[model samples]
Target: MWTPNVNTFFQIFLKNFKTRKTDDFSATRNSLCVTIEAVRKFTTKRRKTSVLSKKSKAIGFIIMSAFGFAMMAAFIRLAGDLPFTQKTFFRNLVAVAVAAVVLCREKVGFKWEKGNLPLLIIRATCGTLGIFCNYYAIDHLVLADANILNKMSPFFAIIFSLILLKERASVFQYAAVLAAFGSSMLIIKPGFSSATFPAIIGLLGGMGAGAAYTCVRALSRKGEKSARIVFFFSMFSTLVCVPFMITDYHPMTWGQFFCLIGAGASAALGQFGVTLAYANAPAKEISVFDYTQVIFSAVLGFFLFGQLPDGWSVLGYLLICGISVAVFFYNRNLERKGQ
Candidate 1:
């Protein structure tokens, strides 16, 4: 019942102050955690959106590439009865000019990575042969048929990668390759007839292109420049074709000459479009869209040349495209799991 002790009062005040400070610190920490979580969510959503946008752009570029290649095939058909070598020469001539300009602009000079020369020669030889075969198919078969046949290159690429790049394939990849070959037989209708010859040649074209692609992959791994690679292939093809073109020279009408030029330009468009596409996204993500070339070729063939694929050919197309779609999905699934 006497006056309160000063020390007792002071100690009570100090305890209350300590409790208040601790509460404030806990509240602040909770608020900071919440803010961090919100920031993380916002950044994750932005990253997902960015990936989707890039994929969309890649798809668009691939579709453009498909149309360009289809148009190039149509122009080759329109050129009419020209030797495949002659057509190849003109096509490579345009590529050479374009590649030269690119190199000069970049100031990369004409230098190549050492030990790349052999692969370059192989790539050029195979590319030249592939073009010759493809041109022959375009001349002989309907445009859709020729284009679909050439589309077999990706499957052939898998096989070549196994042999040349020492890459191992999954069981699914091997099965897909077999399925693709079976599908090609439906289009080819294997026989000794002259009608089947072009289809066979078209298959060879796909194989050659696959081999050339493998060589290109090897060159790229060795740090070779893409423009230099293109320039070398174009120059090699042009020089090789010169002798054949001179021997089998057939003067072209202005119409035919212009058609060939259109073919060359269209091919360039296709090359650049595909390059842009792969640059933006991985091949597995967008490669399936490349089958659109068959669709474009079909439409062009029907309208321009009044050509229609037979039932067997249509079946082949469906099967091949289905396999591609399946592989594409499988790859996406694996990528998602890895992530």
Candidate 2:
């Protein structure tokens, strides 16, 4: 609700301190004593934070988003006996509730133009399917493997941007995309195996997410607020899935119900975190940190599920992560040259 800009936040936060002198006596400014030592201490900490730049903040956001999603996935696995549709419904329901609270507090519009209705519906549909498929994959596949497969979204996002946004991809970008696909194939090794199906589904989950995000970008270009987009998506998904959930829902215990709710809460944080990451820095500059989801999932899977990747899977991780990091630096260098 009414998030202030960086300048406004700092200005409001430091106003009283700014008005004080080095020898100002103790006095309450806003229900708390403002002593000279407290002012000096805050100033010292502020000066010590000179090295914390926007890029650092963006990377921090990306890492947080990754971690949040990893925790979400782990919880989804913990609730594996439930239907994917049920899990998706709860996840979006919780997100919608949180978003509703913020929207009501901010008094934001719950309505949009009829023209944007189609795009919003398309976005919500794709996003709902993406979450459904991702949760299914998490239940069927190893947590780390499912996460790695879902990480294909960034590559597919670029591809979707090319097709839907008429964006041009450079040779290096194309190379990285190809390398990511190759590595995904290596990890899946899909032939005459039951694991093949879930791996394929995980890849499709990434595709769905990629398409949904492409729609999100288009919505942003049309000046839609991110909060509004999230709220609409969550509301749409919850409504559409409720009927299906009622028909096929398996009853979950109280513990499972709360875990799924926690998964939903985590998903909301992940969504907000990634949104902030890209808002603060260029996508290329910070997207590499998104891969840390695989790491977090790997650790969680090891302890929670006793899952570990084999030799080929490890190689696949290296290939994908290496290409992603390379792509980031390559784009950064190109930007520098253009400047």
Candidate 3:
């Protein structure tokens, strides 16, 4: 869970080789022994690479998390079969109840800063609208496709950091952002009517979430617990969404109620995992790994929903993945130098 400095990867990589060298040599014979031993050691070394291990575990976590999130989307899609406002309202209402129980059990109390009130309200508004777009988008598109587009939030975060936070932009970060956007375009094929407005809404959802993240980052320094922030969001979203739900009310079947429960639980889980990730690792260190959500979405889409990314979409996915990884290392290296 620790985000290793650049030196950590090098040290770990070298240590693995040294530790395996003897066993590696024993497996080989006379003339080609040395070469084979070296190759064996190298292979083993790469296989045990800290970078690869961190990335693999990070990606795995994301895949599991994304599956839950995708299911949430599927629930939203089903809910969309009714009215969007009504569905969204119920979803947020359930989410509020769920979050409240968790917060109560944990004794997570909130002490609102007078200065942070406006920011809190703003973030809550953004969160509500973001959820609206996300639910609306998934209703019109495949759950996996909508998710793939939604995963672009990190790219937007990187860009916004540069513009708003005045954070230094490394070439790799720029490349990662470009890759993310390019891949998204490939996946959705912007301006194509075949993909239509829902795709754009999905993209907007990413932007909205991206803005929410930026606000989270901004308020993070103000010493608020992430859970408290999430709690507030759920509370406010429930409040705002309730009025709309009553006007557009529709009776729900038990199946739909179950789906709503599942969506709330999964979303809460994913949000907690994300918060834990930041607690365990730096934002930039963990941010790039988020792109793995797309890979997960693509695979899940194909298997669960019979949705597949086209060749162009595949290419874009690769670009996004490559750049995001590059940015991770770039940031890690910077962190190593105490930047």
Candidate 4:
């Protein structure tokens, strides 16, 4: 199983979920898509496994991860009127099926250490709630808005880590976190706004994401491998969601089915790419690169859905991005000074 960074996973998953609406495709496109995805699984595995320069591979992985996630969001949007339960089912089902094959091929054990089982369960549970909140936020808010709120996970992660893991928080980190929260409020603009409720919901979703990611980080420190962590969580997410699947099941058209499949395939590719990217280099070096997802999402929102960020929202985006970049550089400077 993979020792995964669930943030990269959700950042791609939930942000895009709120963006594109999917279209009904012709039979030809559906068939072609299935065929392409079958090939893609093989390609994704080889691509991740192949030898390459670390930075080059990490950058390549991050780019592909963003693109794959963008595609997943488009498919989710295209799924049209499907029950969220059903959609979640298909999204996670496809991801697990593909990721399972990768884990087996990589010779990674799926068995958990009895001692670490609790951590795995906690991580999976948090991850599942994160997904649920992500969908809710996506359904309720504008795509761009939903995504911006979801990205607040990083800020929340710091807090969660400080509280739950008893990790030390730097003064600089606290300041950046405050800036991020302030920026989020600019996007929320709560007074006299109908969006206020969902904005709050979106913030909770971000909290869920942060908690989930912090759990994964703790799990990572327990000497768990990435695939192992991911495999267990994916399986857990699929199984726990079964009741929702049974109770809220909706019949899907072939187009919807294929779109979900495509979404899964894209997520699978992203899962592999992101896992590889961070594995290859220190996160400080490559983590900022993933922020390109915001740009990709902005472009996607505009072209695909005719949506764009408002001026203050754009300023909010800039604030969050600026603080994140600053935090990265500041952390890097600290590391250099310490060295």
Candidate 5:
């Protein structure tokens, strides 16, 4: 990665110019040009290597995030028959504790920037609702199905960003969205059956998550700290769940209690992993890797719950994942051309 300094280059050029005759001036100038070109090539190569290294790290972090989320979903399913709200409370309770510790360690006071309160509320509200729907889905649907449905948040985020943030999407992105929606129908398999209800709710949960993520993007752009945003959402969700949790509280055995705790910890791992991932690289680069959660969930479901997705569900997974891969490569190609 090292290259000749500008000063050093000039010094060499001047020395060559002084040592050579007037007839050799052209040769000296050409030599300097060659040196400059070499340096440029070296630096460009180093930069590309650095970027590749960062993308590698981002992929690893995102994969870890996927596994963390899959584990969280599995733990939720393992918690047995309990109120979704009650489970949500425990999840956020752990988040609140973790967020509080982070804030304390960072010495960042819990203060929202003025005019950001409304967006914070929106983020928390949507996030709480999303969690409720997701927990319910985990309780009712197959674990992999629930995981894949929730993973639809990114596409939903695109739509919400367009609406809320006034961001414009390209034709390919919109096409990807449409293809994703059509693919999701393969899993939803809409009908007048009781089973389909949870799938619909799961879809709505993905939409809520997308909306919440959209708000988070806005807040981040407005200079909100990640820790504060997480703390606010965790606290807000915890309080929102209090009343329902109290009223419909089901007694949990020690095992179930620990399972919920495990869910919360795994969720925190996912949250932090994703945060680190995107910090290293843009979503377009690493987001497709998040689909790994579906595979992880499928493995867990099969071994633990004897759950296996049927043929249609498998088709849905392939289409959705394929669409994501296409979108990812399309975005990368555009970036390369722009560069």
Candidate 6:
């Protein structure tokens, strides 16, 4: 007769329950209790192994998401030789068209309530600014450097969360901000063509993005439909880009056009993937995987642009990632305490 440990028994029982029947919270709770008991009994090494496994899974998802975003960066850089506004115009056009086709096919029309329009507009404006700044940075900076700098978003998000959302940040979040700023300075050292304007744009874009996300969180509370929000973004951005599309636009080569398509499609897919990630996993768990963007950007930059970040830059990457990891765990700990 084999006597299984609580955790082992819990795993088997949960697996069987998931396979056999409907998802009942009572059953899940019982299984979870068993698993917790087993966890309590586990040796330190076993517990460490379990923690590592969970981290690995979370890292995998984040890495995938970050890679998708990096691909968007590469494509944007390739398309940036065109007029900035024109690039924006076509990209938004493609995205809007794609979204419209999907909505029509699915018969998922959005009903716009008057009260929600302001929130929707605000979200769209923030997204548009972020995309615009990112594209402009791609045009001006080395691809890897731009990506590394853009990773500052999470850091900025921390501050914005404090100011706009009135949420207190952990010490780890402050450390992450310092690390990101340090990394950015390494990339754009002083007296390097005054990258100040572009950097400011990037930073503001990041802050705006955080505010947009906060609004999304708020809307989610009120049961606002994400599809409606997305629809507003698609429609509004396309409308805004119309003047840019008409003036000073040049014909693009097939290659250039294809690159724009790639950027647009990746943005659409990445948007959906990121939404799902935040929904399924804790932000702390998902955010750490964002570090993979540096790796992806480095690889893509070297292969496509013949640009490589220096040792200082690489070290900076590590520092930024380290801080971000610390922040994630800190937030996770806070969440555990129900704060």
Q: Write down the lDDT that model 2 would get.
A: 0.73
Give one digit per residue, the lDDT tens place, for model 6 in 1-339. Answer: 124476676675666567635578877776667656655555444655555455455445556667777787688778747876677666666667766776678777777655777777887898777777766766775544455556666655555555755656546555555665666566445343467787676666666655665555455445565555556776787788788777767898888899988877776655544543433343433454565566677778889999888887688677767766676666556554545
Index of the highest-lDDT prediction: 5
Best candidate (score: TM-score): 5
Q: How many residue pairs clash in each candidate?
A: 0, 0, 0, 12, 0, 0
Candidate 4, after superposition: displacement of residue 157 in Å? 1.2
For model 3, the superposed segments whose C-alpha errors exceed 4 Å read 1-68, 78-80, 140-152, 184-191, 194-204, 275-286, 308-324
Error of 4 at 145 (Å): 4.9
- Please, what is the TM-score per model? 0.69, 0.70, 0.69, 0.68, 0.74, 0.68
Q: Which pairs clash in model 3?
A: none
What's the best-to-worst order under lDDT? 5, 1, 2, 4, 3, 6
Whole-model lDDT values for every prediction: 0.74, 0.73, 0.64, 0.68, 0.76, 0.63
Report residue 199 deviation for candidate 5 (angstroms): 5.4
Off by over 4 Å in 4: 1-70, 142-145, 177-201, 269-291, 308-325
Q: Write the per-residue lDDT of candidate 2 for residues 1-339, one digit (tens) a residue.
A: 122356644554476556656434453344124444455565555543432355567668878988888888888778758888898889889989887887788888888655788888988888888887887887788755776678788777777777887766666666666666667666656443369899999889989887877777677667666677889999998998989987998888998999999999999888767755655554434555676676677678889889877889788778867876686666556544542
What is the C-alpha lDDT profile of model 5 across 233-254, one tens digit per residue? 8899999999998789899999
For candidate 3, give the lDDT of residue 58: 51
Error of 4 at 198 (Å): 5.2
RMSD of each: 11.9, 10.2, 10.4, 19.6, 4.7, 8.6
Measured on C-alpha atoms, candidate 1 has an lDDT of 0.74
Residue-by-residue lDDT tens digits, candidate 4, 90-208? 77788788778877998877776558899888877876777677777788777657776776766676667768777666666667666766776665564433778877877787787
Question: Candidate 6 at residue 305, lDDT?
Answer: 93
lDDT string for model 1 (1-339, tens) is 133356644554454445453567675565556555655565566665566566667668778988988898888889988888888888878878888899899998898889889988998898888888988887787755776678777676666766877766667756765676677566656443356889999989988877776677677767788788878988998899999987898999999999988888787777656655645554434555676676677778889999787899789789878886786666555544544
User: Could you tell which candidate, 2 or 4, scores higher by TM-score?
Assistant: 2
